[model samples]
Target chain A: MTPLIEANRVSRTLADPEPFTLVCDASLSVAPGEMVAIVGPSGCGKSSLLYLLGLLDRPTSGSISIDGRVTEDLGEAERTHIRLERIGYVFQFHFLLPELTALANVALPMRRLARLTGDQIAERAAALLEKVGLGDGAGKRPERMSGGERQRVAIARALANDPAILLSDEPTGNLDSANTRMVIAEFQRLAHEEGRGVVCVTHDATVAAAADRRIHMLDGRIVAGD
Target chain B: MKGLMVLLDVAAAHLLMRVRQTVVAVAGVGVGVGFFLAVSGMMIGSQNDFIKTLIDSAPHIVASDEQRSAARQPALDAFPQAAVTVRGVRPQDEVRGLKDWPALLADARAIPGAVAAPTLVGAVAVRFAGRTEAVSLNGIDPRIEGKLAKIEESLIGGRLIDLEARPDGIIVTRPMADRLGAHVGDTLVVSSSAGTLQRMRIVALVDPDARAGFYAGDIAGYGLLRTAQVLFARPNVVNQIHVRLPNPQTAERDAARLEARWGYKWVSWEERSRDILNLLVVRDVIMYAVISAILVVASFGIYTAVSNSVADKRRDIAILRAMGFTERDVQVIFLAEGLAVGLIGVLVGFGLGTLLLEALSHAPLTMGGKPLVLPLDRGLRQYAVAGGASLVAALIAAWLPARKAASVDPVEILRGAA
Candidate 1:
């Protein structure tokens, strides 16, 4: 099976007077329909690696390929376009626009990608929201929604373009245990049933345990993988 | 640009959020524009009327002698050896001796820079048509008067006085014309300022000021200088010879030179209507001060409104930055709000100002000697200036706020908001 993303000898260094390396000598491949979770302690560069993998950040020294396109060599606009069309981000804070409703938030990725008609985009957004258990709350703004619901909406928003890969940074960090389990279960279903690869960075052992494979990061270096 | 479009949307939202403050700020500017139009219109109208009156009555500068005792004038100032004669002149006559009336006229006509200065004399009746009023009579040379004043232009319902033909004809103002129930060719008798009575026929009626106090159908402008002198028993000598200046204001230097050359006195129109012209200038100052006060208040309103919006929208701007909206976008959003306010203000101001001016024009308001007439076309420049000032004020007021929005920290805003 073709790998949707590959990172070769990637290293990201934080430039400052102290100059600590966020990710040092790391390499990884994410295959189609794979569910991978990165487990880490505080300051372990798990989120930074996720950012680099999602093309939202560039590695200091490495080659990153997304579906065979070299992201490191791409211009800023082209990198952003790749992020818009093929990479969906789910952050712990959701970052949904307060002025927009759940439906608009979920439709955002499609809106930027320009690959779907308005009606098709709306239909897909509705189905995604339905899959995330927000069947009738499309018109509600993020501020009006519960934290769990907003995170769910963010998850739905991430799948907006039906990208081959999903990247999440602390996706279940702000949710209650029940909501976290449900969200983890949804990610499992998306990987297994929908056949889309997803990479998640998490501090919670339960979320890491739920993934089909796990990688533990310590001090900006990957220590073990399962 | 799409970014600009989004910026406008943001601006529109901003305007909607603080509707009352925005409306008040806009209204303040609108009033300023309106006030500009109204006041400037009145001033410009008055100015235009005054200038037109002066122009229509050409030879804007008229040099006239004040002495009225002499029976005749030298026909040619340049002709040092012209013959002069008079019927009742003594050998020791203090008056200059003259002979050959026809030859004197011919010699006078031939002088450089000196056109014909035909002369006239007549008296206004103290009482006419049962209405008693002290009125001064004037003697005039038709051809010479036409060059110096709008003698023919002001004649409303009658022909101008024909000095060549009737020679006994006179013109009157519309009010005086109406008072006597007189028209062209109507006979009217007038007594001089010195108690000399003479009868003359009305040939024309004219009004120098149309707003009030006079009419085109009423002051008597007599036809011929000869007939006037003959009727009033004054021969040859004339009070006030209207000399045309080549260049109007520059003539002051030349006038001083002429005064030195001929020992004659002079007065500029500014000197003639010193009080009113001074008043006009003071009124202009007061107008600027008043409009400035409104602008200062509006400027404060703009400052408060834009600053307040900046504070409220800081997070939104930061989020935009985080989402890759450039600093330029942030600046444009706030500035666009200010501009939108100014545009709406200008539109409202024009409506309000034009309405007020039209109302005043139609209303019966009189000032000093003229009725109010708003000249909108003349007021347009002032309107634009005031509107531009308001726009600049809004933009300047928005400056600090826009800078704040541009420099907002995305992480801090999210942290604080969360």
Candidate 2:
């Protein structure tokens, strides 16, 4: 099967007073229907690579492609469009806008895509919340919900536009072990049963163990298990 | 369209979350607009009332003979473009009357909707019962001047048509009559600068108080055209022709046409009172300038409020950016906040301004130690202008902070947190 995301020898460098590298010469791919985990020590550039693969950051050298389309030369707006329509992200902090409720948070991406009517958006957002096992918390704001519930809502928000690939940077980093297990199970279900690729950067060994494949990185390079 | 809806929703949510800051911004704009409405309304309303007084008591159009400097020396016409300057040029002492004024008057009367009257105006002294008083002597065709100046409406003792009926008849103001201790039918001798004297009967008297507070109350007397022609030593001539119009608003256009056709100095009421009109313009400029300054200061309040909001919402901005919102979307959200604040302020300001004006109108007002009636303008158009100006000021102030929000780098922010 064709890979849903492909990164070929990508290297990202920072241009501060003294130049430094974030992700150096990393090559990887994740096919549809697979859950992959990127595990690393502190400052090993695992999150940086996740950002590069999600098209949130640009590489200083080499290219990354999503669903067979190369993205290095795309303009900012075109990149944003690609991210909106094809790739979804869930950060470690759950990052749901505190002002909006769970359902509204999930509806935000669909609203930006503008292909769905108000009723359709609401219906789909409710369905996504229920699928994430947070149906009862749909109307609750992020501040009122627990950290695990907020993370679940964030996951539902990531899937709002039915993106082909879900890129998560430490999706369970702030959650307790039970909530971390719940998130891992959801990621697994998304890849194995729902036919979407899932790539998560994580430090938790158990979270990494649940993935179908694990890519370990050190000093900005993938060292093993790519 | 849905995007805009969502943007407004988010903007409203942000503002609602920081309710205190939003209220402060709105109230600031409201105060500025409210003051603008009340102060400008009073000034403009009073000005309109004063202009109405001037228009009502003065001639709509005044046409006078153009004075010439010795017919331009005849030889100077040959060198029309000569660069040589003439110094202390003096005009020949010609009789002070329009030549062939009867034909000019006829032409003036021929114009549609024009009520024309010829007047030979001359400074004169009156002698009655061994007392003398200086006054303006107006030589008028009483029948036409009656309609042109509304003199018939202000008569106190006798009718104005008596000037036409009695050849040597005169109409004096009540003050002039009292100063002379003269009664109607009392004979008075009128003498002009030309050293001519004539005895005229006081056929009528007009009440000066009929049009109180108007400068037309100056001590004056009027007589038949023939009597004034003889007294002023200028026969069959008039120095001025006054015109009345069906619609006073057309006076300027009519004066332009008449001056161009007749080579006379045609002055409309507006031109005759240009100084007063200029004063009104200056007053309006100062009023609006000060009011706009208040709005600018209020806009600074909005600027600080929005800037603080942007600073506080950096996290939400980063997340929204990651969620595929373009920079422009972030900018629009903040801009919407500013506009919403300004709109709410304008609405509240309009209400407060109207209430204030209503309160002012009910309060006792005095001017020059006399009870005065306030002419307060409660027009919607002025409020609309004030509201629009406030909105523009607020938008300008909102622009800088919104730009800062849009230029935020999401990766840098998220990386710092990570």
Candidate 3:
């Protein structure tokens, strides 16, 4: 089967007064049901490479493909639609909208896609929250929840659309070790048990140890584990 | 529909987070709309009031014989295609009267929607007690004049029927009666410019001060048609024909048709008050300009609020975009916030305006020594205009900030925070 996500010789460079290269000639791919962790020092372009693969940022001179469909030339609207339907992203911080309840935050992506009715959306959001260990925090706002609970709610929100590939950028940077452990376990189950492709950028050894494979980056290039 | 609901929900959540700022923006627009309504209502209402006074107090149309230098000569009448100039054209100094006025009056009465009457109007000097005053005397058939002008309604002491009972009878304005120290049964001598004198008994007195007050130059007295004709030394002739149409708005058109058919000078009330009517139009333009300025100033407040909202919610915008919301959706959410504020303000403003108008309408007023009421035009058109204008102002003010919010780059913001 084709890789769930493929980036062929991708490079992202910043156009600025003092120019800088974020990712250079980095080609990588992840097959279905694989959990891959990108490990690197700070300013080693790990998050930058992940952003390009997740279709959140444009590469300067290379292309990306998700589920064997190339996405380099798609318009902003098409890219957004693909992001809504094909990919999910979790950030370092929970980043849940402070005004919405935990359930509503999980349902935001589903509502934007509008493929489900209001009741179906709500029901699916509730199930997702329960799956992430946030069943009791459904009606509570993010401000009222603990940091670990909020991060779990964010994970539930990312999975609301049942995307094929899950991407994370420093997913546990703001969490305690206990919360980080819970998040790492969730990523493992999402890839191994649910048979979804998972890619996470992390500095923690425990998170990298749980992954099926690890890619190391240095100076904007994939140094190993191609 | 479902997509719109989500947008609205997001907009409501955002606004609810900034309750105090939202209230301030809403109140700003509300005050703007209220002031607009009050000022515009008063201006339009007073315009209507003045127009009503003009239409009610005078004949809707007056058709009179044109003043000309001389009758056409045989040469001027018979010569075909001739531009003949006659030297030394002299005006005939004769008493101005319409020839065959009774037949013309009958023809005028035949017109539809017109109340027609022949009036022999002349200037007379009245001597009573020790005072002599120059007064305008209107000679009319009491029955026809009563229908055209509400002569009976102005009667203070005696009825208009008294003039019919006594042919040597007159009705004088109360100010004139007071100046002459005359009563209902007193006799006064009235002499025309031609030195023709008649002693007429005052049968009634009308107080013009009751409604539209009489001006100092408006000394008015009335008599029977025959009495005026004898006093002016003219028989079977009237100088003026007055017609009151069913609708004063259509008087100008009817007067134009009458002048075309009768070969006379016809003047409608609209033409008579053109100068004041033009001033009213100018007043309206100035009123709208001032009101719009106030609204623009009020919109600035909304602008600041929306701008700050965009700044405060930049992170949220980036998050929404990452969640797959289109830029258009983000823009619409902010625009909806502005529209909600405007709609709420308009509703509150209209209520306040209604109360203000009610207060104004009941307040006592006077103009020209007569009691008057403030004309408050409570029409729906003005309210709609005010509401629509305020909504537009709010939308315009919100547009820039909404665009700013939509253009926020998720990568730039997300990477910065990370």
Best by TM-score: 3
Residue B103 Cα positional deviation in candidate 3, in Å, after optimal superposition:
6.1
Ranking 1 against 2 by lDDT, winner: 2
Judge the docking of candidate 3 as incorrect, acceptable, medium or high: medium
For model 3, residues B108-219, the per-residue Cα lDDT tens digits are 7777767898888989999999789988998988887777766677777888777899999998988888888898899999999878988999998887765642221348
Q: Which digits, one per residue and each the tens of the lDDT, describe model 2 over residues B207-258?
A: 7555432336656778888788899888888899988888778889888887
**Each model's TM-score?**
0.62, 0.89, 0.91
- Tell me the tens digit of each residue's lDDT in model 2 across A170-189: 88889998999899999999
lDDT string for model 3 (A69-125, tens) is 899889989988888888898998778888899999999999888999999999999
The most accurate candidate by DockQ is 2
* Order of models, best TM-score first: 3, 2, 1
Model 2 earns a TM-score of 0.89
Residues A1-226, candidate 1, lDDT per residue (tens digit)?
7688898889998687689898988888888888999987877888778878877568999889999877887876676567666777777887786767899778755654556777888899999999899989999988899999999998898787777788887888899999999989988888888888899999888888888899888999999998
C-alpha DockQ of every model? 0.08, 0.69, 0.65
- Give the residue spans of candidate 3 off by over 4 A: B67-95, B99-111, B212-217, B362-372
Best by lDDT: 2
List, in order, the clash count of every candidate structure. 29, 0, 0
Q: What proportion of true contacts does candidate 1 retain? A: 0.00
Which residue pairs collide in model 2, if any? none
When summed lDDT is taken over every stretch of 10 residues in candidate 2 chain B, the lowest stretch is B209-218
